[model samples]
Target: AEAYPKVKRNSKFKVLDAADIDFFRSILSSDELVESRSPEELASFNQDWMKKYRGQSNLVLLPNSTEKVSKIMKYCNDNKLAVVPQGGNTDLVGASVPVFDEIILSLKNMNRIRDFDSVSGTFKCDAGVVMRDAHKFLHDHDHIFPLDLPSRNNCHVGGVVSTNAGGLNLLRYGSLHGNVLGLEVVLPNGEIISSINALRKDNTGYDLKQLFIGAEGTIGIITGVSILAAAKPKALNAIFCGIDNFDTVQDLFVKAKGELSEILSAFEFMDRGSIECTIDYLKGLPFPLENHHNFYVLIETSGSNKRHDDEKLSAFLSSALDAKLLSEGVMAKDKADYDRIWTWRKSVPPACNSYGGMYKYDMSLQLKDLYSVSEAVTKRLNEAGLIGDAPKPIVKSVGYGHVGDGNIHLNIAVREFTKEIENLLEPFVYEYIASKKGSISAEHGVGFHKRGHLHYSRSDIEIRFMKDVKRHYDPNGILNPYKYI
Candidate 1:
């Protein structure tokens, strides 16, 4: 590794004592920081779920408390070291895994539920708090932290807040942006600013706490958060509807949304290829719908009560069925049935990867232009001789996301990972997104993966503003120095 030279006005910060390993060890538990002396020890967090970025910088630092993280940050700040904060490491863009010259700050050790307020409907937990664990915490207290995702068990609250992540329930409950009430942040200078007050309204001054919410920890490390929980719906009804074309699918979606407002928790679509992949991955978990169909939608509704919710859901489905807006429809009768319907939607990513290598792109675009942009991207890639090629990133499978919220997740599969493919696909995808007045990053923030794509989503003025923010908060460029802005 290269030396950590003095770079800025605050360049007198001390470099870490790699020789005095015990100094670092005292900040963590015995099981916290693990280096690879053996293959089995390194296998757990070595390879991230994202297959594209698979390099290793495994000086993994796992601090158990905010104080420990603060101390580590203070040390790193003094040394002008860049720290990559990770939780569960379930990131798709390879942001969780590090490049060659950085140390990993794994938040897996700090997961702990601090408080549960049923009356106010807020849950305070450490950043490493797993979504699934929070769900169970809510169930125990008659509440739930609403940031739902497929990797609920693995992805932690810290990562979710850092990414300002969006998932299936985003259509109804809104993403982390809306539901998060407060946060406890670790600034780049190792100072702890506790915003976990759980107040619904605080119009004292500039809402400065928000800047780090989606900054992806490049500006600072988020130690814990206080989230406003969405009350758990008494009943959940899921339906699988297959459409023949994108136009028809769009029409049906508009109609369904026109009728149902917040009850429409999820409106995810599954391509035939994605459906088949799920069926293959889990033997008994059949696709539950026709594979030949060009597009399939798994619409889910969660209402305040069961019987009343079902009646309203039935009316919506019956009307759609009679209107011929849907080619097929199957309503879930039980929990098992609903899970079966969801398998198709969640399999979209794994399907894109399992079949071959993959390039995953998630964008925030106008709902009307979602499918249209996909078509355009595919056409442009085809013209560039990248779409149908064997070892290039090919737009082979397309799925639906928080269609109700205008966030779509699309994937391209190839036989191998190559710099050439990224070079070609990036400009093509990002430029098209910009053309459509869309953001290159929808839920996922601009980490290393989307650093180059920032200009596409941002204006010249916006880019300069972001640079100013970086300048003010991290003038030394010591906080995750090569990421975001």
Candidate 2:
């Protein structure tokens, strides 16, 4: 894997010592403290999910309650010790892991469902609650969390809110900015700020809670969340299609929206390269369609009535087929079929890494130019003689992502991670997005991986404003140093 990017440690922060550990132990139980003296014990906490970044932290604190988190923050701030607040450690961009010797403030122990109002669809929970567990709680109450991700089983609710994650269902339920009612956060100096209300319409001053959403924990650590849950659909169906090209994919999407309308929940895109890699990784798994095409699309619908949803989907498929928009297609007729179809879509990322290493870029671009960047990068790699059989640096570059939100995930699988390959992609990818007036990051936050590349997406004034906000809330820069803006 590629080496962790080099960044100078901030001189203002203090190194961990016995006194610090003793102070933490005073407020927390023995189970809550993990003295990272053993490399094996801290391996998972220090390294990121992608195995691309690593840190050498000496201490990890797990607080079960907001009050305990407040106490730990107060002590760390008083001693000028930098801290990295971690949750689940499932962040693809290295946002949840420490960059250096910064102490890790993990919230894994805080996984608790605080309250739920079935009538109003308002659910409250501790920030460390696993998303899948929260979703199960809501599901039993005939409601569902507004967000859905493949990593739901492992990702923490607080991490999703902090990153402002946009997942498969974003096309339907909307973003956390619109669904989250309130957040309870702990400020840098250990002050508790609670706005965890269940009000749907509160025209309050400034909507201050929004600042922490998508802030990536640079300003404060989110401890509790109150969000408006959506009612679970009684009937759901999915369809996978093979399209002739990107143009037909767009046409099919517009048609699906017009025909499927209210019941449509997700629209995902996968290029041929992505499909091929996924199939290769699956090892002898049959393709969904009779023949392979240049591109594929997955469309899902959810509704209250099974008959109505089935009719709508059937009619939409008939119309699309009549228009010659799809080369071939398969619709889920049973729950097993639905699950199998989603597996095909979700398996694309892991498949990209089958080659050994993968460089992933999540971006937001206009639908018209969504796949162009991937094509260009592939061409660039080919021109540099990096793509080929054995001994070649790159195996393939694939493109796929959520079509509803104008997001695209470009993955380049290589024999191994190398500086030359990274250098070839960095500014080129960022500049391409900037030229298209697109965001360098669509859903992923500008964590340590993308921190230096913020200028490619944000104007100087906007970056200055972000830095100003960071300094205003965390003057000591002790919270999540060397991350975000």
Candidate 3:
């Protein structure tokens, strides 16, 4: 494994022993309990999706049911052994991986759709259920999971809820906090707390489920989820617009929301650098435009009335063109075209990292200043003599994101991860976002990556309250120790 900066293991947590392994083996089948002589078997669980953070965990427990999970947690908590609750392992931040020798508690084996009520359009399922599988099941019942992402094929529903992932369809369906009704979680002490309710409205005291929705597994392990699915739209269409300037991009967004109104599902933006990186990474995949523009916007509409949606989108586009808000544009003629257009926008993440490494910052900024951070970082790197072709640690800076929601993904692609480059970015990026009254993290939680930098976005009192909540739930701090509270 690649060497990363070493993080000291908490002295309060106990190191796993043979007795602990024996206990896990007793409750789980051989297949469920993984301990390999070769280190490669546990590599997937030890390293994060970004391959930036690595752990030295030798054991990974895959409980087949919540009961098994409770038993394992109870033992770990009693022994004060640190545990990392992991799902699909698709987290961008370093939250899913162990920081040291902490045991990995994977939920992959517990995947199962428990129940679905067609009349109520609510579904209950294990936390390990893949997002794509949930979407397919919902589609069969003429319903849809409100969240949608490029990693849907592997990302688990519980994982998204844990991170409160706001994906492509967030603009139309809202966040997971609003859509998820209840959850079944395993506390650090192995106590099972089930708030699984199918009711749409509940005036009960203290909606406790919300606490764990975006807690990032520091408080507890989520085993099951109850979410309200959305009704499938009858018609969907997409359009790609090339804008001459960032100001015009903002104008187009305002016009789109006003004209497209309720039918607008997504409004994503990509700057020139983002598009160039995507085009380079996806070799042979042409840009959607005939001529290069300073900025690009992907607008999508979904509604029950196909004719009405199509007319609305067309009128909106015409108005945008008439006002000279966009320089060029293209509308999808069919499903194939729609998918192709979205591919360009979704390809930016991987493309930015295609060179060697990518330093990602997912931030919520004021609409007009969304892309300003990326530009500032690029200028700073250039001034520091870090950015260049090969041999240089830094490559280039790119920005893209859900424009309508003011969430910008600022990515700094580099030839490799180096302390010099990291030092230049940290605190600098956080301070800039704080100055703009923007959040340090928008969707991705403050895992191991942003734990120390929480003050950038939250007040001291807010952080203190968060720490108190952590202590109340997991007094021993064995559940995901060394992570953000």
Model 3, 1-485: lDDT tens digits are: 24645557688888888998898988999989899577798999998878888888999999989999999999998999999999999898899899889999999998999999988889999999999999999999999988899889899998999989999978889988789988999999999999886478887788888999889999999999999988999998999989987788888888888889899999999989889888888899766789998889999999999888888888888877888998888888888999999999988888888888789999999899998988898899899998878788877788889987899998998888888888899889999999999998899888888878898889999999999999999999998878887
* Candidate 2, 201-310: lDDT as tens digits: 88867889999999999999999999999999999999999998898898898998888999999999999999989998888877778888899999999999999999
Tell me the TM-score of model 1.
0.91
- Provide backbone clash counts, one per model: 3, 0, 0
| Predicted candidate 3, C-alpha RMSD | 1.2
Query: Quick one: best lDDT, which candidate?
Result: 2
Clash count, candidate 3? 0
For candidate 2, the per-residue lDDT at 261 reads 93
What's the lDDT for residue 480 in model 1? 64
TM-score ranking of the models: 2, 3, 1
Collision count of model 2: 0
Writing each residue's lDDT as its tens digit, candidate 1 over 1-485 gives: 11212223223433345652576787777877876566456544645676555434547788899998899888777667666778888887656655543567888888899887788897899999888998898887777678788888899998988888888887788767778888898887889988898598888887777887788777788888988987878888888988787777778788778876667788877666455555665668555655367778878888888887778777888888788888878888899988877876776677677755677788888877887666765565577776554554563645556667777776766666656766767687888898889988888667667765688988889989988998887776766655557
